[model samples]
Target chain A: MQRYKCIVAYDGTGFAGYQVQPGKRTVQLEIEQALSKIHKGDSVRIAASGRTDAGVHARGQVVHFDSKLQIPGERFKKALNAMLPRDISILDASPVDMDFHARFTSVRKEYRYRISLSEERDPFLRDYAYHYPYPLNLEAMKEAAQYLKGTHDFTSFCSAKTEVVDKVRTVEEIIFNTSDDELVIQFIGNGFLYNMVRIMTGTLLEVGSGKKAPAEMETILAARDRIQAGKTAPGHGLYLWKVDYA
Target chain B: MQRYKCIVAYDGTGFAGYQVQPGKRTVQLEIEQALSKIHKGDSVRIAASGRTDAGVHARGQVVHFDSKLQIPGERFKKALNAMLPRDISILDASPVDMDFHARFTSVRKEYRYRISLSEERDPFLRDYAYHYPYPLNLEAMKEAAQYLKGTHDFTSFCSAKTEVVDKVRTVEEIIFNTSDDELVIQFIGNGFLYNMVRIMTGTLLEVGSGKKAPAEMETILAARDRIQAGKTAPGHGLYLWKVDYA
Candidate 1:
């Protein structure tokens, strides 16, 4: 048996999410189905670096699978891409050591959220960005983002649906960038909890819109309660930008 | 009665084309349908700057329509946008002089063709760019593009299906730009014939790939025959970037 690692990119528009759920279309199910076909009816399971919510796109999602097939590593990319739908593509594929775990070995992950401030909706970017017609105070948002950069208990930013007790995580960097009509926020961290990034984004947006003060981010973090943070931003605006492993 | 000029944008993935057919989903049909909805069953027609082929996107397509609805120009934009499908959007709308015509009054039009030379297909840009997975000489393509600029009889570059006899058209500019993995070619001209831009892109790509010499563009133009040109590029890679009227 041989283990293979691959970097994947997907549009995520039509996918239920990254995980496999019975009767639901998902990125994992599609990739497994394609892999099963290659394995001649044998089931193939893949482990991903992380799970993305529905409508969340990925630019460099990493995954690993063990297989007995003797085909070359480069050929797997071509074969899998040919079978995969247009929205999902395997960017790179290579054999990895048997001990390499896609999820456990990841050192850092980066996510980007795009918010379009254009008064008019952009037809092309409708699926890619969250369109917020209201004016936002960029300086206020940047000030709030600074508070989020560092190790903290992110329970207030996490989804209540998760049962994970260890809500502490280290956010290494928070980058805020602006163009003419869009605000891009990038988060680099050791890991993110369920809906953590989206909830954080919502909180920053509220600060930017004057609904909440920049200092409120610290209060929300200190509360360690989900209700203390703002609402979860829509998943369509979120992208798993990149993942790092060592 | 009022004449309204609007700048429209569309993904064009699900659209048959810009023109309305008996039983087809088209940009014009969708706009007219939305207008008719606003007019309470009174049929409405819109004249576009030009027709785009099926699968061709648009960023700044100009159109004019006569309406009896006594709504303000800004309100018209909102109402029309609400009625139109997600794929199409009215970027801007305003009342125009009754004498203004979308097609006849147009002085220049710009079309963009994107060619992705990356070996891996980009899932995000799958619908917007053509994945040509081949080495291309960018310098050769730019040199060939220069030969096609300016006033010329472009019979060899036009589609054979076109019935328009006067093939003499002035190409104002040809801009060749490159990023890390994509080549963007923009053609600005007074007008384009049926599939003219696609043919020009294909011919230039041929020059870039070393399949045809850069100097051959001049010979192909002088031939005045459609058979002398390269294959027509796919319509999906084309975009009606902008239209200007004076």
Candidate 2:
């Protein structure tokens, strides 16, 4: 058997999530079904770098699987894409070493959140961005993001339902970019807990809107409680941008 | 009665076209229905800068209508947007002079066509762009576009079913831009004949793909025969980008 690595992109609008549920539609389920067709009725399971919540898009999601089929990487990509639905696409596929695990070997992950600052809703971008009509204080948001750039116990920023014991994670960088009608925030981290990025985005938005002070980030992190953080941002605006393996 | 001028944007995925057609769901029909609801069952008719073909999107489409309501401009915008569907949006609305018209008074119109040059299809932009996986010669396309600019009888580039006798139109400019995976073509002109832009785009694609020579544009124009022009491109990739009047 040969291990194959693939980079995938998906709209995520109609998907339940990346993981497979009993009867729900998911990215993993769709990919597995396509692979099963290629394997001629035999089931094929794949492992992804991480799980994304329902309605969360991905531009560079990474996954891996082992297969006995001897097909060229390009042919595998073409065959999988031809069978997959329009919303899900395999951007690339390649054979990898047996030791290369998609989830365990990942060193970094990047995520982006898009917020539309236009007072009027844009018809085309309705599904891709979170529309916030109120004005934002960019300076305050930038200052708050500084506090979130380093390693910390991100328990306050993670979902309370998370079963993971180790809440400590290293955030390499947090970049905030603004355009005429939208604000984009990118988060790069060694590892992220469940709902960590969305909670952090929500907290930054509160700071940007002047509802909370920039210094409050320190207090939120120190509390180590989910109640100390702001509300979780909607899933639709989040994107699993890229995954790095080294 | 006051004349209201508004700039609109729409997804155009579910719309038949910009014009009103019986038993067909069109952009004009939706706007008129919304206006009727606002005017207490009194149907209101609007005149747009021009009609867009079926499945063609619009970002800055201009329209004008006569209304007896005494609401403020901002209120009118908010009211209309509140009633419009998710696929359509009223970006701006204001009272215009009695003599102003949406169609005849317009001096310039801009249209854009998007082509995806990526070998793999992009799921997110499926409805917004044309997937042309073939390689294109940008320089060749640019050379051909120059011959298309300026005043000319566009009869060969227009639909034969059109009833308009005056086919002479001035194309101000044709801008070709390329990104990593897509090519965008913008056409700024005083006016366009029915299906003229699509036919021109198709002809340019032919030139870019080395299927036709650039010098053939002059011969096609001199012919004044619709059959001499290249095939019309699909409508979904076309956008009524903007309508300008001074």
Candidate 3:
């Protein structure tokens, strides 16, 4: 058996997210079906670094699978691309050690959220950006984002539906950037919980809008209650940017 | 009556183009509907810098309309934006001279054609760009584009379905640029013929693929037949960048 690793990109629209659901379309099921076709009369299963929620996009997602076929590393990418849907693309394919699992090997992950801070909605960017007509105070949001960095129990920012037993996670960096008409929030961490990034974006928005203070982050963190955080931002504006292995 | 000139942007995916079509959605129809709603019982008609064909997008399309409503120019923009659909936007609105007409007063028009040269289709950009996987010779295409500049009889390049009596037109500038995995073809002209931009893009792609030479432009021009030109590029890739008046 040969283990292969692949980097993938996908527009998460028209999908029920990355996991396999009984009645809905999924990125994993589509890729597996394509792999089955390429492998000729045999079924193939693959695992990804993480399970992104519905409507969330990805620019640098990684996955791995073991196949009995002895296809060259280069041919693997080309064949998969030909069989995959237009929305999903395999950027690269390479042979990996048998023990290198996509989920187990991933050590760090990065996500970026986009907010359009303009009064008028942009027609071209309607689907990809979250539109907020109200002006935001960037200084306050930046100060609040700084408090989100470093290791902490992010229970208050995670969704109530999360099944993870432990809520402790290390957020290595949180950066805020602004353009003429848009605001970008970037977060890098060892891992994330269900809807954690969206929740963080909403909380930061409240800070920027003067509804919350930057120092309130500590109190929210200690509460360990989902209701202590702000509402979750829309999934469309979130992008899975990168996955790192140490 | 006050004449207002407005700069507009739209995603042409849902419209039958810029012009009003019977029983079909058009950018003009959407804007006019919004104006009527905001003006309250006043049915305002709009005239645009150019009547873009079906499926052609715009970034800086100029339009003018007259209304008797007593409101500030900036407020009109805000009102129209509130009433317009998600696919259309009024970027700016201002009072203009009574003699101004968006079509007749326009002095220059610029357009861009986007072609994706990647091996895999971009599902996110599928509706916004044309996908061509073959390797293109950008230098050769650029050289061929230069020959299209200056005044020339574009009868060969113009679509035969056109209703205009004149086929002669002057091209002020034509440029072809290639980035990491995309090709952009820009054109500036006094006016364009029906289906002209798409035809030029198609002919240039032929040149880039080595199917045609730079000198063939002169021959194609001399042929005075649309069939002699290359295939027409897809409509989704073309965008009306701007209209200039002096």
Candidate 4:
């Protein structure tokens, strides 16, 4: 059996989430089903870099799977894309060393959150962007985001229901970009807990809107309580932008 | 009666077309239904700048309707948006003079067609762009497009089943803009016949791909037969960008 590593991209609008559910559609389920079809009904399991919540898109999601097929390795991308739905695409696929683990071996991950600043909702972007019509104080947001960088226990920034007990993680950097009617927030970190980026975005937005002070982020972090942070941003506005391997 | 002029936008991936067919969902039908609801069961009709085929999107489609309701003009936008589906949006709405007409008074229109040159299909843009990976000769396309500008009876470039008697129209400009892996073809004309922009794009693409010579465009125009042109480009790649009135 040969181990294969593939880069996948998916529009998360039609999916329940990244992982497989009992009866719901998901990106992993679709890929595994396509692999099963190629393997002549033999079920094959694949592992991804991580799981994304519902309505979270991926631009460069990494996955690995083991398969025994007679076809050449280069033909895998085409075969899988042809069988998969249009919302999911196998961007690149190739044989990988057996030691390559898509999840455990990942060094860092980058996520992007989009907030639309248009007073009028854009029909084309409604499903993709979080529409926030109110004007935000960019300086305040920047000041608040600075408090989130570096190492800390992100208990207050993650979902209270997150089963992971060890919430300590290093946030490498937080970047902000603004265009005509959109504000993009990028979070680069060693790892993120469930809903960490969304909670951070919501907290920063609150600071920008004067609901929370920029210095309040420090207090929220020190509290180490879920209720200390602001509301969680919607999943539709978040994208798994890229993953890096060491 | 108050005449209302509104600029509308829609993602055409869901609807059958712009016009109201018997049972198929359409942009016009959705707007009319929203208006009917606002008018308390009195069916209201709307006249648009023109009709678009199935899977054709619009960003600045202009429409006018007569209403006897007592609501202020500014609230009309909010009310219609509240009732219409998420795919459609009323961008701007206002009271217009009695002499203003949506269809008859239009002086110019701008339409954009997107052609994606990426070898790997982007899952995010699959519904909005035409994935054409092959390289094209831009100079040849520009030369062919030059022949199509100004006044001409665009019989060969329109659908053969078009029932319009006068096929003459003035094509003011055909602009090409390329960035990264996408090519945007913008058509600015006084008016366009059925399938005119799509057919013209297909013919120009043929010229660009070396399938047809740049000089063949003049001959195709002289023939005045729809069969003389190349195949019609898909409707999904086309967007009605803007409309202007005198």
Candidate 5:
């Protein structure tokens, strides 16, 4: 069997999640069904770099699958796109070395959260961004982000539902870009625990809104408890921006 | 009673149209219902600058109405917004002179059509932009726009259903701005007949795609027949960007 790597993008509004459930519609199920149709009824399973929750969109999600089909990369992309729904797109596909495992080989991941800071909620952006609708101290948020960077056992930043026991992860970068009335926060990390990005955003927003001080971040991280963090931001504002592989 | 003018923005995907059609959900119907709710079940009518087709969005649609309520404009704005759905937004509201009219007193209107130029259709922009996958000669489109940007009887560039007999209208400007795989075509004109902007865009696209010559626009304009122009572009990609009043 030949291994193929594909970059996928999806608007997750109508999806249950990235992973397949028995009856729920998901990104994985859609892709696998399309692949099965192409292979004439043979079951084809795909491994994604990670799963994103329902309503969390993706711009550059990476996945790998094994196939015996002889179609070239570009032709395969077109074929998959034709079979998939409008909300999902196969950005690119290529045959890869069998050594490339989508999950284990991923070197880093980038996630982006967008907030609409306008006083009035915009109708067009209601679904794509979190409506903050409050004053924010950018300097305070940046100060708190400094405490979030580097290696840490981010137990406070993840959800109680997270199954992974090893919570230590290296968050390499935390970027904040404010443009027009929208604020885009980008996080780059070797790996993130479930709901880590959303939790971090919620905590940073609390700091920015003066509900918490920048120094509180240090204590929150050291607490090593989920209760120490702020509320989890909504899934709709978050995007799986990119997944990088070595 | 005080005459008030309001600026509105809406995502038109869910609306039937801007006008009140019995048994159909329209933007005007929603606004009127909201006003009635605020007025203790008293029906209130409003006049809009113009009507937009179903799935045609608006950014600065202007409307005017007379109200007997003693509330301030800003407070009324807040009240209406609280009553309105998430798909429609009241951007601003202020008292206007009784002589002012939304449709008749408008000096000009600006409509914008966005076209996605990328070879691959992006899922995020599918509802907001018209995806034209073929290569386009922008220079040719601009050259054709020159012929379209003058006072002329736009019979060929409007829907056959247009009611106005005097089709003469002044198109003051035709501007093109291309950036990041999207092209925005803006038309600023004294007035537009029904489906005028969409038909003009379709005709211009034909010239850009080498299906028609730039000079052919002049002949089409002279023909004074709807069949002389290209197909009307889809309503989803059109925006009533702004309305100006003297």
Candidate 6:
């Protein structure tokens, strides 16, 4: 049996998320269905680098699946892209060892959330960006992003639906960049819990809006409660940027 | 009564273009409805700088409307933005002379058409940009754009649905820029008829792909027939970048 690893990108606007659900469209289901056709007469299931929320997009989402066919990795990528919808594409595919799991083998994941901070709404970027008409304090937002870096128990930044027991995660980098009327906050972490990135964005937005201070992140982390954090930013702005395997 | 001229931007994904149509959602109707509420019993109608085709987006669309409300122009901008749907935004509103008509007083309209040349699809940009996997000859495309500049009878480029009696229009400038993995064509013209911009983009694309030569644009323009030009490019890739009145 041949094990293949593929990098996928999908626009999650019309999808119910990455995971399969009854009576709902999903990125995983569509990919598996395409794989099943290529594998022929065999069921193919893939393990994703991470499951993103509905209306959340991905740029370099990695997935791995073992197949019995001896198809070349390049050809597999082409075949999958051909079968999938225009909103999804297989960027690259490669042969991997049986032990190489897409999720387990990942050492880090990068996510970016975009906020359009302009007085006017950008009609062209409506679906891809969160429109915030109020002017944001870029300096305050940048300062807040720095405080979120390093190892911390991010219980306050996670949603209530997160099933993970451990809340401790290492945030290697948190960068805030404000360009032209848009603010992009990028987070690189070992792993993220359900809605962690979105919640963090909300927390920083509060700081930018002068409702909170940069030091509040420490107290929020100590609270170990979801209610302590601000509301999660909308799913439209969140993007799974990349997955790194070590 | 004060007449206000505003620059607007919108993502055309959910709108039925800029015109008002019964039983269909449109950008013009949405703004009109929002303004009507602020006017309090007084009907508010807006005239647009250009008529964008369905699914065509805008970054700097201009519009003008009259209102009897005592709200300042800046306050009106803020009020309209607060009440408008997430897809549309009134960038700025300034009191202009009642005679400054959006369509009639316009000097030039500028548009930018973006096509992603990367083979891998971007999930986040699916609805906002056009993706073409095939390689394009940028040099050839630029050469064709030059020939398209200046005044000409663009009957071949105009759509069949165009109702204008006069087909002659001045092409002030046509510039092609290829940066990273995207190809962007910018067009500044005195006026365009129907799908003129999309047709020009398609013809240039054909030239870039070696399907047609750059010199053929002259022959096609001289033909003065719709069939002579290339197919109309998809609406998703086109954007009304700006309109210049002065």
Query: Model 6: what is its DockQ?
Result: 0.66
Best by DockQ: 4
Selected candidate, larger TM-score, 1 vs 4:
4
lDDT, candidates in the order shown? 0.94, 0.94, 0.89, 0.94, 0.95, 0.88
Each candidate's root-mean-square deviation in Å?
1.4, 1.7, 2.3, 1.1, 1.2, 2.3
TM-score of 4: 0.98
Structural similarity of chain A in candidate 3, as TM-score: 0.97
Candidate 3 residue runs with Cα over 4 Å from true position:
A39-43, B39-43
Instruction: For each candidate, give its TM-score against the true structure.
Output: 0.97, 0.96, 0.92, 0.98, 0.98, 0.93
**lDDT, candidate 5, A1-246, per-residue tens:** 989999999988889989999999999999999999999999999999999998999999999999998779999999999999988999999999999998999999999999999998698988789999999999999999999999999999999998999999999999999999989999999999999999999999999999999999999999999999999999989999999987
Better of 2 and 6 by DockQ: 2
Better of 2 and 4 by DockQ: 4
Residue pairs with clashing backbones, model 5: none
Better of 1 and 6 by TM-score: 1
Put down candidate 2 lDDT per residue, A34-63, tens digits, no spaces: 999999999999999999999999999999
Say which prediction, candidate 3 or candidate 5, comes out ahead on lDDT: 5
Which of candidates 3 and 5 reaches a greater TM-score?
A: 5
Model 6, position B82, has a per-residue lDDT of 83
True contacts kept of 5: 0.66
lDDT for predicted candidate 1 compared with the true structure: 0.94
Candidate 6 lDDT, A1-246, residue by residue in tens: 888999888888889999999999999999999988887747898999989889999888999998888888898898888899878989999998888999998999999999988766676567678988786787887787777899989888888887889989999998887798888888999999889999999988888899998888778888899998888999999999999988
Q: Which pairs of residues collide in candidate 6? A: A123-B10, A123-B11
B95-164: candidate 3 lDDT, tens digit per residue: 9888998999988999999999887667777778899999888888888888788888898898899999
